[model samples]
Target: YEPSEDALQVEVDTKTIPHTEFLTYVFTDLSSTGATVALDWAKKQIPFKIEFDVSAIVLADIRQKLQGEAGFQRQNWEQAATFAMNNGGDLQEALGWINNAIEGQFFSSKTFNNMAVKAQILQKLGQKDKVLAMVPEMAGMANTNEMNNLGYMLVNMGENDLALKYFKINAKNNPANANVFDSLGEAYKIMGDRKNAIKNLKKSLSLNPPAGVKANSERLLAELGVVI
Candidate 1:
């Protein structure tokens, strides 16, 4: 047997068997008379293998973009909660989403992140004891980002000293990140340490935030009566 660009050729010993019967079988199985036609055209002696070619078969591809769209529609509260928690680390927005999720019964029975989100919502809602209860569950799962988020929640709840500990951990892990400096500055400001606030805020600005963040940081510094 030999393979061509589009087909396979088979050689059979004509002395052993007649070509006509073999051609009929090949044509019947292939569902094409082209193989039989090619066999007749070949000048080689009988009992030779004939060449048959079939076009390549391809299956259609499926795209999964709709699955993502559906997931977003079905989990908007969770998505918004995650976004607000990560971006500004805003407690109110996180709490709003958590409350929405709870009232809507969106994802109340899930694992760690879900529990953490709910605990954070409680912290923002002034349920400090409840938030503290969830801390043990969150401790082993905590990362720099999680610590930063907890720090932000603590800051909003006027627990500046505790907030500083988490923010310091986050800053230590991510020294070059401007948001860490910004968060540390916010913590210092809450603690009534204007000098450290000014210093860290300046460090945040020095890292060269994007245009929007730079403008907002500048406005915040000005509000704090810092000459930035």
Candidate 2:
């Protein structure tokens, strides 16, 4: 394994030991739990190799074990949920894991974050009403700064429409804040709504925002060929 290159080169002499035989032996020895355990052990043995190149069967085994052991722990459940979501192989399974994380604890710190992930999963699953239902809770939990950051984060992730949703929420909640409108404008611009972008950016500037906020609004307006 080359640490700098991040590549694992396995050399085997086919004359002395056939490649097929080696693979067969490895597979036979490392079945379900065995493969998972070996991967875990390898992570400990090999520094810089956080993830292993294992089969889907081994990953499924690990996920199953994690779910079974998650019992009442918000972080554990959230971790399992995140892993399932990142897997992207089964949206229903990801939804189940995130639901488990959300319901595991009544007053957990991870509850809101879990809800956000659930909303994303729901959106992917085409559950628009359910995703919309979560907006109040998510928006209520987030402050102006947090909401602004989240909206931009979604924009960076190319989720412009979803980002627009949060930006609208922030503008509604913090009507007096110039930054909120600025963020809303940026989201609208990314969503290709030039009219709304100009409207909100103009609103932001009119609010007498700080220099940075004023400059950003002006810049966006300039990009849209509107010098307001």
Candidate 3:
């Protein structure tokens, strides 16, 4: 297989070890216990200045295997996160590791997709506050249904602080979307923020909402004792 140009660079043995012996060392150390052994081997193999493409191939394979392992030990959380983000490995364990990655810069240069993966894991863990905290300022994450679902879930969980923040962000990001406005109105109503609730509900009605949205908004406006 071709060595990818995107190769990992680390430290290697100044004393030349034979390739067969290195492979033997790896399998003997890591195969059944999880991949940190190969990862350790690969880290030790990364020379300050790489001189051979053949070595890059082995290093890439070692990192790939390490990145794909599902080990859940707190010490292994970083690797678990890489596997979870890239390979759908373990949502629960990924949360712990991603938080660690964010804190420790383990992800090289974390992408918006990596942050989105964190949000996804938090949502799966039913952590409304954390997911809501993660959504704003997360670039390219504008799935309307996902926002509504998260907002409603927060509301159901009585996390009004997070729900209001989430729906307000959804409304701001999706100004003309009546469903977003309706969700915002419900959050405000739940907060006893009657004035904003009635205003958003009216805006939702005027935006030519989907079939059921108009009725829901009007009912909420009435419940807020506002004439709409």
Candidate 4:
């Protein structure tokens, strides 16, 4: 029979069959239809196993390890933790599993989704305060651009003090980034702090920021009545 589109190789070896078993094995390049034909003719499935070298017990052990829930837990720690948290299971155990997976040789479970799983577990355990305490970790995990743009957003919303709060935090966290100083300068300029604005703007310019940032800071400084 013609092989299906998904077939890599299809062959029927008659020499492999037992002569005394009164069985004529017809291996077809069939998928579901082949199974149906085999069931109708042979009353049992002739499994498609390529390994003639390995013992059946070895194959069985490998199959069990692969298809078992232990295999799922080993590979899918994130998914398993998420499921445990969602189902209101033993959250501490789930948290342990997640943390171990993160710290272990598997993958990066310190990310947002895995952290969200920890939050969900904390919420489930009635430690709402601890869940709120994840805010610091979340803030620490915030990227530089995230902090800068958030401060700019607050400034646009007419919350200059709040913008300064985030900008100062950004500056403290990333003192070396020229764009952070530039953003802080803009926020200070919006708040009418011409002195500090010029200070940070000059700092940004001195640090050699992006192409337009120096010119933007210089223009803002000029608009703030700074001579140069």
Q: What's the TM for model 2?
A: 0.53
Q: Candidate 1 or 2, higher TM-score?
A: 2
Q: Which parts of model 3 are misplaced by more than 4 Å?
A: 1-140
lDDT against the true structure, each candidate = 0.62, 0.70, 0.64, 0.66
Clashes of each: 8, 0, 2, 0
For candidate 3, report its TM-score.
Answer: 0.42
Question: Which portions of model 4 miss their true places by more than 4 Å?
Answer: 1-138
Worst 10 residues of 1 by lDDT: 54-63
Model 2 per-residue lDDT tens digits across residues 1-228: 557796564433223322232222122234423431111132132112123544466457757676464445667656666665666447787777677667645524544577778877777787777776776677678767878866765676566787888889889888899999998998888888999999999999999999999999999999999966
Clashing pairs in 3: 10-46, 11-46
How do the residues 1-228 of candidate 1 rate in per-residue lDDT, one tens digit apiece? 335564645656543333343343223233432333234323333433344332211000001321344323425556556555554555675676556554555444344566677776665567889887776556556776676777776677776787888777777778887877887887887788888878887888998777765776677688799775
In Å, residue 130's CA in model 4 sits off its true spot by 19
Would you list the clashing residue pairs of candidate 2?
none
Q: Whose TM-score is greatest here?
A: 2
Give the Å shift of residue 76 in candidate 4. 23
Candidate 3's residue-wise lDDT over 40-113, tens digit each?
Answer: 24224322332334334543453455456432233344444655545544566567666755555444334454
